[model samples]
Target chain A: MFFVKNIRIGFRRHPLFENLSFAELKPGTMATIIGPNGAGKSTLLRTIAGLHPMLSAAGSANKSGKAHPEQPPIITLGEIAIENLSLQQRVKHIGFVPQVLPQASSLSPYEVIFSSIKSVQPDLNREEADQRIEPVFRKLEMDSLAFEPMHTLSGGQRQIVSVAQILVRRPQLLLLDEPTSALDLRWQLKVFEALQDQVKSTGAVCLMVMHDLNLALRVSDYLIALSAGHLLAEGAPVEVITPAIIRQIYGVIGRIETCSQGRPWVIADETV
Target chain B: MLNPPAKQIAGTSTLTNRHQQVVARRVLCVTSLVVAMLFIFLLDLATGASNISFSQVLSGLLNSSELTTPEAVIIWELRLPYSVTALLVGLALGLAGAEMQTALNNPLASPFTLGLSSAATLGASLALAFNWNDIALTTHLIVPLFAFAFAAGATALILFLARVFDARTGTIILFGISLTFGFNAMVALVQYLSDADTVQQIVFWGMGSLARTSWEKIAIIFMVLVICVPASIIQVWRQTMLRCGEEHAKAAGVDVDRLRRTLMLRVSLLSAIAICFVGEIGFIGLVGPHIGRLLVGEDHRFYLPASALSGAVLMLLASLASKTLVAGAILPVGMVTALVGVPLFVLLIFTYARRQP
Candidate 1:
């Protein structure tokens, strides 16, 4: 199981959220964190990914002058604390895809993914590395564009490449911050399907920070809602996403509607 | 849904074939550049003040004892040192530039971007102005020794600042720019205070030349390249990941901050030794990697050696032009490098642009 306990994250002096703990995430499930703007969704994902630092309880002085817990946050995968693991060990277990797209360059997507895997697993020869990479490209259906330079690829295509890079590593826990932000609707669904397949096949836990609440509700096995440094709700999407909770979190009057396939669909009616 | 087994096999084979073809093409490009560099190296060895023919130079190289004393001295002592220094210096700058650009994440970064060349120039200027040769045991070596010391000092300072400031790419670049400007000003002040002959000597050094190289200097530079190039090649995968972006590299488990620091140290060592031995050979560090990137893309496995070979060839050709461009008066190799490299670089860029559909 993946778990975060009493995590507080923010910039140096200002704490965005404190004493935030969530442990409902289990293996072989896709979880999505959804919130309004500045709700610390990405920051939370980054903290779990080890890209951002978790604040000490005695972080910095705040205007309210409230003392937090003295201990640092504990993030664990299975039984091991993430902070206690070495960099190589952490990478082998956790994969993170940041929100930003990669810079344009002469490197092809194939080269980027191949090199990414080789860098982490340097003992793997070319054939072994190629064996790992070809399947990902085929699964993602990016085989034709594999050799094209990154600069020539579209933003959505590059986003897929970024996802593909992390997937090839086959980490036990995947953390992606808005992985589908740049993708079109079809590509976004394809990426979701790919993530689902990965979770089902490998029993990996995938946590993604998503902007589109409707899509998150439609696809995620588990849903987390945050608002103003608070966990507004967390559970199965059908149980967690209600009109009242949506209004409280997003400050918009939203209705929960069921799709033809019996998935929850969020319909924003108007600003509250 | 997956493809059928037969089609999947076919697709895999096609990808393997395409990848092999790409690797083969890059290997061919690097091999051709090495061949060109060798040809220019021979040409450089043959063309000098002494009236040695290409065949004579080859025979002399093959059998040193068969040649007369004067011929041996001319070939072994003078021409051989000059040509080898040019080749090694070219290799150093090109490799340094490629690493620097990747580490700094800036396309325009070169070996001199960190101000090592300017620091060397300042050192040479101070040695010239103060006439340090009078106190030194080896008169001819005083200036280069001073230059090397100052360049190494500057490198240490940069590394120290990088460590203190967390080695952010933007902060390192800003510090490097400041160092370059500060060193250039110091060089100017020393130049202004020096006597006319001292000023002339400093100016010549600033223009740079391979004329003053010796066997010892060539060996020193060769040793440095030997150690640094392989060290760099070992990090080829990490460096290639860096070319994608720092964040990407970091996510791939690379310690970006540590990688930057190590890369800076290697680049500083290569360029410091190179610039100290031969005044300030510009253009090679800046353009060699560009030519290499155009020839073989950013895969550092191919790109690094390609950059080194490109630099070696450019330097050898420039050294040859410096010797033969005028009658009996060899121009400074530094000046010839820009003159020879600019047109060729421009043509390469145009061709690359045209080929990109």
Candidate 2:
């Protein structure tokens, strides 16, 4: 199980989160972070990814890189502190899909898919890596786009390739930011389905920041809500995504309805 | 959740076959470039002023017994060294160019553009101006040591500016231009202060000649290449990772700053090796990797070697042009390359732009 404790993150010389503590993020499940703009959603994801410099106990940031375990900004992924792990060590367990796909990469999708594997698993032969990625490409139905250059692919196709980049690695902790933002409905469903299968089958912890509340509700196992960098709510979808909380955090009058699939989805009616 | 049954993952049979074919094609492309480079090397050796017959050149190579012959002396003392030096320097600059561009995250980054070689030239000019053999250091090592120190200093300055200003690729490139101008001024100032022979020697050094290299210098270049080429190829995975994006590479367990710093040092050393012996050869570092990319996309596996080979090819061809452009009279190889490379550089820019989605 991976757990984050007492994370206080913010921008340069300004505070966003002050001594923010949360419970453990268990394996074999998915959690979505939902908040409005400037709500520290992306910042939080970046902090967890060890990109941001964490605020100290005095509610200030002196250094802006990885956080130490003795401090408040530690993420415990298994036995080791996530911040202390080397990149080579980190990639073995953590696969991160950034919100923005890297631009101007002229590599073919086939090269993109295998690039990380070459670095992360140096022992895996070319044929072995192909065997590992074959099933993922087949499942994603991106087999036809495999040889095409990355710049030639559509945004949605690039997003799928990004997801495939992570999935082929099969990390124990998968962190994504708005992975489906560029995708259409059918591809979104397929992407989420693939993620769901990957999480359940491997007992990995999948965390993502999402704007689509309905899709978030249908797919995620746990929920974490924030507004203006403060924790608004966190629990099962039924308890946390109530209309009252939606009005407080999002400034919208929302309704929670039980769909035919028995999933709790949010439908925003009007501004409060 | 909705989808078809897993017909795609049915068996691993089809994926490997296709993957092997793709890998083979890339290998074939790189292999062909190497062949082309050797062909150019041979063509370069044959077409020079001595009018050594093709049969004599062939016999000189195939028959080791003819080592003392006039043909062997021409090949050994003059043509072979020049051609080998051209090939080696081209390969070094090409590799350095590819690594620098990726590390700096700037398409325009190269030894010449970034003033790296200029910095070295500035240092070499100072050494030449002072006639600094009186220093306690070994006589032969002093010039290169001085050049390397200045080049490293320039790199340090650029990296420091980048960190301080939170500069991205554009800002760093601007700093590179400033360094280039500053170093060129320094070199020019030193030339003005020197006596006539010193000035002439410095000016000739600045023209970038493979013809001046001795076997000793050739061996030094060879040693640097043998050490550097494999050293870089070992980091192909890192280079590929960095190409995708810095943050993305960081997330995958790469220390981006550390990687950049290490590459800066390596590129500094490689460019120092190039300019210390030869002088400020421009444009190859900018255009070489672009040619490599045009031939073999961005796969560092093939891209790096392809770039080095193309670098060698361009140098050989430029050497040929320098020999032929004014008949028996020698034109500066640097001038010839600049004339050839500027147009090729423009073509690559358009090609890169057109390929963008």
Candidate 3:
């Protein structure tokens, strides 16, 4: 299990969070970060994923009431301050699927997947990279798009392909920032299902920032709600995704009904 | 999820394997092109100037009987060095351009764009205005060396600033262009100061030519080219990673500072060696890699070498065309390269850019 401590983070002069505290996220457990727009939910996820560097805990007040180092072993996904690590080393354990799909020139999807492992062993006298990447493409259902240039891919297809690249690396910490935001409803479920399977097979901890409350409630084992860059609540989804917490974090009037699966079903009250 | 898509497909239909096959085929084709280009190079050498027959040229080259005296002298003494020099310069410029494009993550990036050529021009102009060497030595040796040193110095300076300030690729590129124009203005100033005789010599050298080539100059090109080529090959992976950006490259385990410094040094060195002796032979260094990319795609492993071949071939063809343009009069190699390179490059940029968006 990877642990992050005394995590204070921000960019420029403005601090996003002052001494934030979270438990060691482990395999078989998924953390759903929920917050209103501009609430630093993505910032927290990026920090834990090691994309952004940690700020000093001494400078900011913390609800957790603790202080720790400025550096941690977190691998961030999108818009993280990852100036310390190298690409090859980062790919080994930290697979980042940035929010914006990279507009790579002339690189085919197969070549894109192959590049993730080029550092492990360059295709020196052996073309083992292609053999290895085939299964990954098949698993992500991107075999049809494999020959197409990455730039030509549709939004959902590109998202899947990005996730596929990370999955091929089999990173220990999979940090995804709204990976399913742009995906269609079908692809949204499909992408999360793939993530669930990957977590089961590889036992990697997935820290995701998801916008859909119902989806988050279903997929997440634990919930960390933030309001204005401050942690509002942390607990199991049934305890945390409550009407009071939703009103506080999202300012929405919503009913917390139990779904058939015994998870909280957040049905917003339009009359609010 | 989605039934995982039919487990697996047959061998022939899979794109992963097909991509590998395509990469392999492109490599083979590039290798063949290099071989064919070399054959043409040898043929050009044997037939030029004196119009020696293929048989006579072959016999002379093989050290056989019935080989005429003039044929051997032309092949060995004059045409041979000139051909090899053109080839080596082409190789240097082509590979350097490929590396620059990848390093800066801009397709327009080349030694020329980075102002190396202009700086070299300024250096050569300075040397000419002052008559740095008393003897009226061939422009082949003196002109290039001066250009090389100044170009490398300019490159080193830009890299240093980039490192210290942590500037983006765009910033660095703009700085390079500004420096080029600045140097060009200085060259103009030096031209104004020099006498008519000195100005004529400087102008001719700046025009770029293969007319004054000798073995000694060819040896320098050979050594520098040999060193630059393999170094570029070894760094192709790093170069490709750099194309992803510095942060990405750093995260990939590359020491960003070292990679940047090394690439800057190599590009400057190769560029200096390429045009220093040749004066300012324009587009081989700029458009060579671009044409190679269109033919071989963007995998640096193939693109780099293919560019080297294309550069050499284009240079040799341009030089030959310049030679045969008018029986008694010849054109500057730069004039021919600019004539061919500008229109072709403009077409490519528009076509490629349209496909991107």
Local distance difference test, each candidate: 0.86, 0.80, 0.72
Question: For residues B113-143, what per-residue lDDT tens digits would candidate 2 score against the true structure?
Answer: 6678788878878877877656434224666
Per-residue C-alpha lDDT of model 1 across residues B1-357, encoded as one tens digit per residue: 123233456645666566777789899999999999999999999998879889999998999987999999999888998899999999999999999999998989998888899999998888778775464433358788889899999889988988887767888888888999999999889988888888888899998898778887888898998899789988899899888787778778887777888899999999999989789999999999999999999999999999999999999999999999998988999999999999999999998888677
What lDDT tens digits, residue by residue, belong to model 3 across residues A1-272?
Answer: 65554466677487877656676666756778788888777666555544455564444434224534444324233333343454444556676666665445666566655654575356533346666677777767777667666556776776776677667667777777888877888888888887888887887778788778999988888778888767888878888888888888777889988778776677998534
Highest DockQ model number: 2
CAPRI-style docking class of model 2 based on DockQ: acceptable
Tens-digit lDDT track of model 3 for B65-88: 565666667778877777787788
Per-residue alpha-carbon lDDT of model 2 for A98-145, expressed as tens digits?
Answer: 888765576877787788788888888877898889889989998777
* Candidate with better TM-score, 1 vs 3: 1
**In model 2 chain A, where is the ten-residue run with the lowest total lDDT?**
A59-68
The local lDDT score (0 to 100) that residue B43 gets in candidate 3 is 66
Worst 10 residues of 3 chain B by lDDT: B1-10
- The best candidate by lDDT is 1
lDDT of 1 at A125: 90
Q: What is model 3's interface RMSD?
A: 5.8
Rank the candidate models, highest lDDT first.
1, 2, 3
Instruction: Name the Cα RMSD for model 3.
Output: 5.4
lDDT of 3 at A195: 80
Question: Against the correct fold, how does model 2 do in TM-score?
Answer: 0.88
